[model samples]
Target: MNENQQSMPPETPQTAAAPEAAAAVSVVALPWYRRPLFWGILLFLGLLLLAGWLFWKEWQQAEATKASVAAQTEQWREHNAALESFMQQLRALLAKDPCEVKQGLGRITSPAGVMWPPLASGADRSDAVPQKPGDLADKSGSGRSDTPPAPAQNNADAQKQIPPVPVQKQTPRNVSELMEQATVLVLAMKEEGLAMGTGFFVAPGYVVTNAHVVGDATEAVVVNKAMGRPFAATVRLVAHDNGQDFALLGVDGTSGIVPLKLAQSVSRTERVSAWGFPGAVTNDDPKFAALLKGDEAAAPEVVYTEGVVSVILERNPPLIVHTATVSQGNSGGPLINEKGDVVGINTFIKLDDASYRQSSLAIVCSSLAAFLRGAGVSITMAQASESAGGKQ
Candidate 1:
């Protein structure tokens, strides 16, 4: 039995080695593509490569977009620079005075008659002789003066004695005539931009307009049909109080233009007319468009609108509310009575907050008179009776 067991053991060691080798062979026989460990490693490496490719592609796209945006930004910056340069040139062109240009061309002609003459020199005047009250009284011992009072001058004799006024030749026959001859277009250059409004002759070489029209400008141009050219004007006075809205301009040569008379009072419901170069009317006219576009030869016609005085507002710096149709360019125009006397200055329009109804507003003549008097402007005041008689 001991010998048989030793032979079996010897066989057993070799057999055990064969079985272990068979198991190893079975594992090696499996294909590498089918093996779980090999496939797992392959899948992980493929996923990493895919992620890297995606990241690189995204980075390249971002760079391209960034470059495009930079190029667009530079393009816009250049466009803005060009626009700024154009605006500067336009402003410089507008600043050139038309009156100065016309004067250089020798187009301005002086009127033959002088409207306002300079005061006589003191040396040219004779001293007045002082006389006592008693000297003219009872020199002949009579209570009444021996020299009978000169016969009361008749209208005919008065007419014959008085010399013909130079302005009489340019006197308008009616209201329509007066407005055409007196109203002027006021143009000025202000910090805000170009400003336009209406003005009228108050005296020889003197024009009245709204203070807002002149703004802070010291110079302006006044265009009138009678003058046939724009006259250079300087701002003489601007009311400090904004409520007054009055300005006086001293024109270079406006002596030939007829002056309008100022009424002392305005009556409610009275027939009135507003005269100006209203934008609503003038803007549509091609001639006026040419005038605005630097055509010095073009003349804008005056616009006349008829209405009635609605009411007189009793507020500080009293205002006149009228039905006369006034618009943007009507500021500083004259609001005249039927008798051709200026009752107010068209200033603005009030709009109702709810209904949006428009109400034309004007500066009362009384306030205008005060403003003129304070500024020492010589204006002709008309009587109520004269205004009534002159009404058509």
Candidate 2:
């Protein structure tokens, strides 16, 4: 065994180092960038960074979306709140009894005028003649009277002898007079609120106003200065076409008031007057609210604005543009000539935001007549009359 061990020879440092050096050479041969194991670790780190960036971008987008949604929700909430408040107020107004409201109003009295003699209470005595006792007996005996019964006075002779008892005129002589008799205050109770507009007597018991004024309401209140009372009215007709915008109201106890006559044609540059209860005139007035609530003693007077026809639009339903100073409550009011005849119905006003200019518009009489005829309403039109100052 000693001899075998001697022949094998003891292990040298170089031989041991030889295996280690071979392993070092293998490690040096493959660089970090070329080694699969090294690259695997680097790829893992790169993927982790990319994932982190994507997550951050998604989180940022979510935050922005959340902010936008919040803003929209707030706006809707405010809008709904305002709508609810309006509905509540409207309900409160509708709860009150209309009759009680009218009773609360101040009394309107008739105008001062000369009193007439009371009529005799009995049957017709106009034909019966007073005779002396002797004359009646003479007539029964001889069928003839000694005085030869005073010759009967004819109607014309009697009328002359009476010196023509003063009588009130039925027809209005001018626009000022027509306003007192024909123009009316229209109060329409709608879902929105109390819509106030101007109307006039187109017939004995019929009033003409704007369809927008009436809205969907089936009834309205008509106030006449001469009548001195509020009359309940029913919607007779409403023009379906938005362009027409006409509505008719029928009121009872409106008889004896002379209806306004409508003109057949109108020309540009003609003088015209608009009659209505414009809100601009009374909106700020304290008494106006009281008047509407029936607390004021007297009704508001009609306003008249004078202007000339600016232009006539040849639309389907012809439009008359005028320079008349009309406002919100002037809708449905009459546009009249100097002779107190209606030529158009004031509808709306065009406003220019940049220039602050206004153009008042009306539906010509021809359109009104056509609407009335379509509804089978009888409207008395004026005969061919002279223009304001010159011939037509």
Candidate 3:
């Protein structure tokens, strides 16, 4: 009993203390929920889960936006297609019956007497006109007013010293003479090349021609019959009346040109002359073709032919039918009566048969007068016509 007591001499409370301490150490070494490393791992896992959820949400929104844009694009394409189809239908309807007037053929006959309308002033048959700058000098002061002298010229010596007013006689004697001076060959150039037609001077620095003659051309050139020098011209304005074509051109450098006067009256079955450079004459004659091709120095002269008024076709726009021969290049030539006055514009010809027996047609003076008045151009002659308000 003494030897057992010596071996357990220090075992009062220490034996239980050492076992409790060991148990406490072992529990601390094992991982717990409150430990720093364990908490770090848990936080990392939570962050990963949160990132995955956000990525899924963004992908869903992107898919929705892409689908919306695709739907709108499809709708616009369908709308454009529908509009294009509608336009094609409208164009097809306008293709038929394009012209306003449907002209007709009349019986061909040769009348004896020319039908002429009376003048607006029957007693005023005189052809007196204002003097031009280049007219022959006249010493008579008949044109000026014979008023009493002013204060400065009250003396008899002042009256004798006053010079007489000189008159100018620049008017041409006949239409044949006017053609040599004022007729011009109009040439229009475009992407397709050169197009040829005829024109005549109506006023100083102004020429009248057909609109079809200057087709698709912004500008044109006029070649004189004498010098053949090309004068630059601008297409100022164009007017078409129920298929009656007219164009007003503003020309440059018309110093000595004597323009033809417009006739206030036109008579049916009257003797008239058509003057132009006809393509029929040019295509057939080698000399004229050479002149056009610039192979010859001599310019082509104006071609004149006489004929009687055949028939007056009254339609939406009235036309004059004459036996005067004309062709393609004579589109804008002048139709002058025997009184040296412009009565009409040579425009078109109707083909009668397969041989193309064509009838010469012209826009009458009445239609021309109305057009010029509407265009605000002042004419020296009166715009008097029996058929003034007849048609377009």
Candidate 4:
């Protein structure tokens, strides 16, 4: 029995050692890197690190590309804005005409003297009935023959002596209609800026304005208030009388404006209006681009002031004084009566003070008539001869 117990104890010790042998065998079976779970975890950690690095690089590259595109877009916008501004300046330069500017007036002078007539009320205010366009039947009828007349030397001579009447005489229109038709804007460039003034059609292709308004320019430009392209003009005739402060200018082309009829006389109580480009409304030198900023600018316009004749002066050539408001640019405008007849040329203003208190003066019809006659312009006023007789 003692031997059997000893043998069983030995078997118990072997059983305990067997578990340690198995553990050692398992540890020695694979190295740390060769184990299946160890290798799988290492590979997964490596892949995660690689993916994080790639994502960070892609994010940095995208940020750089976005910054470069933004810089290029801003530069292109600046270049486009600069190109548009240059085009506007080029268009304004091309619109100016070469013949619009002139150098001198060359050998033009005023008449010896003008007549200063006493005030007279001879202007006819009767409404002018419209005349039809046709040849008037000859009251004499002496040249008529039943048979056809042969072309002869005597007939040609007789026909030359007697001139045929035109189809239509001047059709007189209302003063309001004439104002819209005849008024013109005169512009002349000087050292300071453009000298703007008022003028009107006196004949088909002729205009009358002030001497100072025209200055010594040989060419002037006329723009109608009725909205048309400016007409380039040559100063065909210029008559200046310092005493009268008047000038007669003949434009190159007919403005197609209705001419106002000249009145032989103007009464002291006549209601009148002075039409012109007053300095109050017109700028001597306007800066359009700067003044308007980015907004579009429009063309300048004229102004009119209404008043009445207060007194007629007793000077050498009588001046018609009025209460019509006048300004620096109103020098060459016409003093038109209620009937729309041109009585005088607006010349100068006498200021009571530096304030708005002022009295305006215009050259009377007698002086204007004398000036027109000296220039060989024949006017058909019913009482022009009688008005001249009063001046003497």
Candidate 5:
């Protein structure tokens, strides 16, 4: 029994020693660079480092995107605030219904609410009547025909048979509906005068001027420099045009003052004689004091200038027009003619910077006349004697 136990123990120890020796030999036989376990450990460490780098790069990108969003939000907030403020101011201005423009707005305002005279009790309030289109039988009430029909009237023969009436003998364009207009001078006390504009006489006293002028004027004074004497006038109704830059002035023309005539279908090149009393006709150039500058002004009478109409720019852009001469004080002056007719009002003068000279431009009174008519005033245009340009 003892010998058997000893042999078994030896066999067990031999088996253990043999397996250890074989493992050592295998370890020694392996190439130094060919360790699978070491290679696997290195690969695991490399994967961990690459994943960490990718996560860091993703985090940085998210941070950049968040910063960009913040900047945009700030900018939008500022822009929205500015827009809200502007809208509020605009609404406030619209509610005022003011006649004259504020400090910032200049002649930029539209021409509306112009008056020719001041309103007064028992004043002629004719401009309040809208002038309707001429009827087949004009205001004269002289039915369709004053003469007998031509015998078998061929168009050519009938024209010849109709003797032309002398211009002087013909009735005024619309004597039944004559309206007056006025001019308003606007000043802003401390600053230079505000907008100065033209107004037409409606009734005996109502005048229409651009509302912007009346809104700025502290006091308004009217003059009828027409009758070799300056007649002082007063103001009545004043309203501004909502859609345009126009004002209406009501004046009392109860005095025996004759209303001026309006020219419709006027020439773009009419030889006009613009007249206005822009301050006692100041003769800054004494040379032109005794002797007027142009042939139109005879006795230094209210500064008359000869200029042909330049343009009729209703639909044209760069509406700036041209004429012979104009000045600042001539804003509400009438553009007249040899026949002593009012054609337009002097508005603006474009300068020739290179030559240091200026050409005049008058806003044609056609549309203005219509506006006056709508405001209960009437205007009549005579048969145009001049062509579209250049008088005979």
Candidate 6:
């Protein structure tokens, strides 16, 4: 009975915590490498971090390299430009400076004075001039009481002698020559902004853009694509004619400007080329185009439009009419002919939307220039105005 009761029960039973520990010790734990999910996660995280860092570093390096290249290129360009300018000066020194252009001696002597530009377009003095009389006084000096009769041969010879009329090119022709001597410019203003119309070299150190472009400009910016630097400019001449729907503005101090040649007036049915900063063709502001704004710029810069004279009208002023279609910015631009001479001033147009066309309108430039001269502020006009100067 005592053995049954004792029953090894008291054989020291294990504690709860102790039994759990013994069971865990019997189970085998899985190795981290053999747990495929764990290993894959680790690998993926490592790759993501490494790739990100590499990309960042590469970006930084590329940017640095680009900056370096740009700087080097700019330096080279500037150096080359300076060298070329110096060479030009040296050549001029070797040759003759126009500033040093003399009048007579060795083709260098100074002449009397500046000659006034002769009549430009309208008036012709060919037949109105008086002829010089030769030896009439000598013939009369025979001291005859009734003046001895001249021999028929002498009279006939005297009658045959004629005075020569001065042959000089008019204003339009000379205006082009002056322009050919000018430099290029990018026009702008203050109250407004960039100039509205296109401009070209009208005379040396001068540019001919539209008057309205520089009309409100307290200031202007001049740039020659060939030169690549901006310069200050002022309006020198203004041939503003709204009725004619054209104006001429002159920029002073630009050299080597190429003045477009002008042709005498012509009727409708003539073929002509229209040139301007239409903002629909080429772009003067290339930077804008590069900035993804190329589309908005329909017409900018210098562009040409060629078409036949759609119509010629003197509705107001004698105008060259055509279907060449012009934009607003075309005002004061040159309407050139096959000969490359300016035939008109790109001035106005009436839209023909139905035809998807534009009616070309231009002021016969030769006539307008003449009219401007006629209404000009000449010395004589100034004097007269002063004499009759009334306060407006």
Per-candidate clashes come to 0, 0, 1, 0, 71, 29
Models 1 onward score TM values of 0.56, 0.55, 0.52, 0.49, 0.41, 0.43
Give lDDT tens digits, candidate 4, residues 4-86: 77776444677679988988878646678778999899889999999999999999999999999999898777666655544
Best by TM-score: 1
Report lDDT per candidate. 0.70, 0.69, 0.62, 0.57, 0.43, 0.47
Clashes counted in candidate 6 amount to 29
Q: Candidate 5, overall lDDT?
A: 0.43
Show where candidate 6 strays beyond 4 Å: 1-186, 190-192, 237-242, 245-248, 282-301, 371-392
Preferred candidate (TM-score higher): 1 or 2: 1
Worst 10 residues of 1 by lDDT: 129-138
Off by over 4 Å in 2: 1-173, 285-287, 295-297, 387-392
lDDT of 1 at 29: 72
Q: Measured by C-alpha RMSD in angstroms, how accurate is candidate 1?
A: 24.5
Collision pairs in model 3? 136-169
Clashes of 4: 0
Candidates' RMSD to native: 24.5, 26.7, 21.0, 19.0, 25.0, 26.5
Candidate 5 structure quality by residue, lDDT tens digits, 232-350: 22334343343233445433333243456666545555666655434324334342232121111112223545666676667311122546455544555566655545566554455
Q: Which 10 successive residues of model 4 have the least lDDT summed? A: 129-138
lDDT of 4 at 195: 55
TM-score, prediction 4: 0.49
Comparing 1 and 4 on lDDT, the stronger one: 1
lDDT of 1: 0.70
Question: What TM-score quantifies how close candidate 1 is to the native fold?
Answer: 0.56
